[model samples]
Target: MTIEPYQWAVRCPETEAKLAIRGLSKTFGTGAEAVHALVPLDLMVADGDFLCVVGPSGCGKTTLLNLVAGFETPSTGTVRLDGKDISGPGAERGVVFQQGALFNWMNVLENVAFGPRACGESKALAHRKALATLDMVGLKDFALKYPYQLSGGMQQRVGIARALTNDPQVLLMDEPFAALDQQTRETLLAEIRQLWQRTGKTILWITHSIEEALFLATHIVVMSPRPGRVRAAFRSRFNESKDPLITVAPDFVEAKRQIIHLLGQDANKEEV
Candidate 1:
């Protein structure tokens, strides 16, 4: 008798997982001065799903990411990954912050290899693996440059490569492209969409840009003001092959419009 490959499904070599957040609530301060950051929010991310979270500035989008990343504790409820409770940061989840986060002293190669090296990989093997990731993000030629010497976009590319090299099942990005120019942001968006297609990693992205959310996400999660809770969720699963430039496309435009609406008609009023 012949045995089958470990992953019967090509899409997932690992066992399918379901991340659950039950009766989650969080508050800051107390009594009259109390601020409710999140209020009984419940969300689930199945294996390989790409979810984008959008909300008003004080809506607790990052707060939610922090809870999931295990950087902070929820005042109530629980965050469980594959039925296990999350008490602290885990290698199962990798994160990329909003700003460019590359080491100024270390060159691009060293910065990208930091995680794997700290995980006990040999120096030669870590750098070797780092090189492969840098190549993936089109930064192979700039591997020797220090963080200060590279442009803002290049620095961000290195940060992303570092996160991707860890092979985390879930990738959490908090406004990762908010710092880049329009053109650079567009380029990186395409790069990320490609990476998602290739790596099949579950991604939870937080962003202020409606187009960006619709472009790279299979699901869009919108939140309301303080005590952030889900206001709306949209499905763009079959919209994968759609180009970002196709924003003018009817479906794309409609989705974009609806997301803007989900943000609340009053937000535009405040921006004005």
Candidate 2:
């Protein structure tokens, strides 16, 4: 589809390649009773890129993610993965939700193996691969631990491991750290940074914090509240060093401030 000049969809070259979302819109109910949760949304996430999307509460940010995850469909527009229209969740797009989503009865190894087994992988091979993935996340020692036995951060790590075990090209996260305390959040942020650097999988993260978006993403897309629309986006060039601590640097703070100011601008316009 031909997105208009400078529209959110047309602006991202990444969307031109791997993943393209054009004039994406979603609504609930019908007629005057219907709520337009999102309107003509647009986004393009490139291969091997990290994109973070932030917006006020109830802005349909998760709705957009759900559409791509194939949990729901857009009322208008299209979401395409590699030029093919998205039908449903596939091995290519791995999702890590806010809730660990881990099977309580299963240990780390079992949880990671679930994806491969569902794909028809042999139990032996799947277990072996799962073990390797657990090691990759430095959770091999806790392979036998159930979700209940692990800390919130550890549980989230296992969630990440399970998604990675399938070797997905695109990793979509929905604020996986929202439940954790500050220190734990910071630690996982660093760990996730290293994981992204080592794995090189493109990530599209949904968050509400300007600081988190500026810290973790190479590109940050900020949306306005209710009937969410793309208010602004920024290319956060906070070095390619892969150090999470650099988020405290001057450049990082400035980028975050600018984005926050932009987000506030929309709130102001809406209030007026």
Candidate 3:
């Protein structure tokens, strides 16, 4: 008897799954007064997949993110990475919040080195790794600056560098650029796309901006309101488009229109 590689993967998920959420759900409080945050949902984030999640308010997008990050436990089902059940936050996954959550007291170099240091890395080695990661994010020269001294975009770069310094298998970004100006957001979006291309890291990002998702995501998932469920999912080619003005292209515009329609339907449903 001969076994094929793909067949073996079915039997050995640990070798195949980068992150997997199976029938996961979340609810806050208890009984009739409880708030149902997420309906049972299944999602598989394959190796190196850049997945962007978009949804209406109260659709549990952030809850889903937190579940996968292990900051919040699912009320039902499970989240797994490399086939191991996720119980809590671990170095295997790195999260970037909406604002640059940097320690104001720490210099840029210290902030970037913080993760490695927490993981028991020697000071010399951690600082060296931090320098390399900072350079990757184009912030090596800002090492001596404090968080308040840097621009909003620069601080976000430090946040990204800090996450990368840990060498996590996956990145969980929750609207990391939501607070930035439009021009800065676009610039950071392009940089993030390039970084993904260079690193091949699996990412699960939550965002309200459809354009941002269209520009950066290889795959996009749209969720319904309240107890959120997947309303639609798309594998997009716009990210592959070389045009800088891809957002205005016919195909991109059409795709964006369809997503807006879905969101509109959810909004209508919520009102009723």
Give the per-residue lDDT digits (tens) of candidate 2, residues 14-54: 43657888889999999999999899966887777788889
What TM-score would candidate 3 get against the native? Answer: 0.94
lDDT (C-alpha, whole model) for all candidates: 0.81, 0.83, 0.89
- The number of the candidate with the highest lDDT is 3
Give the Cα error of residue 73 in candidate 3, in Å: 0.6
Per-prediction TM-score to the true structure, in the order listed? 0.89, 0.92, 0.94
List, in order, the clash count of every candidate structure: 0, 0, 0
lDDT of 3 at 103: 100
State the TM-score for model 2.
Answer: 0.92
Compare candidates 1 and 2 on TM-score and give the better one.
Answer: 2
Q: What lDDT tens digits, residue by residue, belong to model 3 across residues 188-225?
A: 99999999999999999999999998898877889899
TM-score winner among the candidates? 3
Candidate 1: residue 91 Cα off by (Å): 1.8
lDDT score of residue 24 within candidate 2 = 92
Off by over 4 Å in 1: 1-17, 242-244, 265-272
Q: Which stretches in model 2 have alpha-carbon errors above 4 Å?
A: 1-16, 239-245
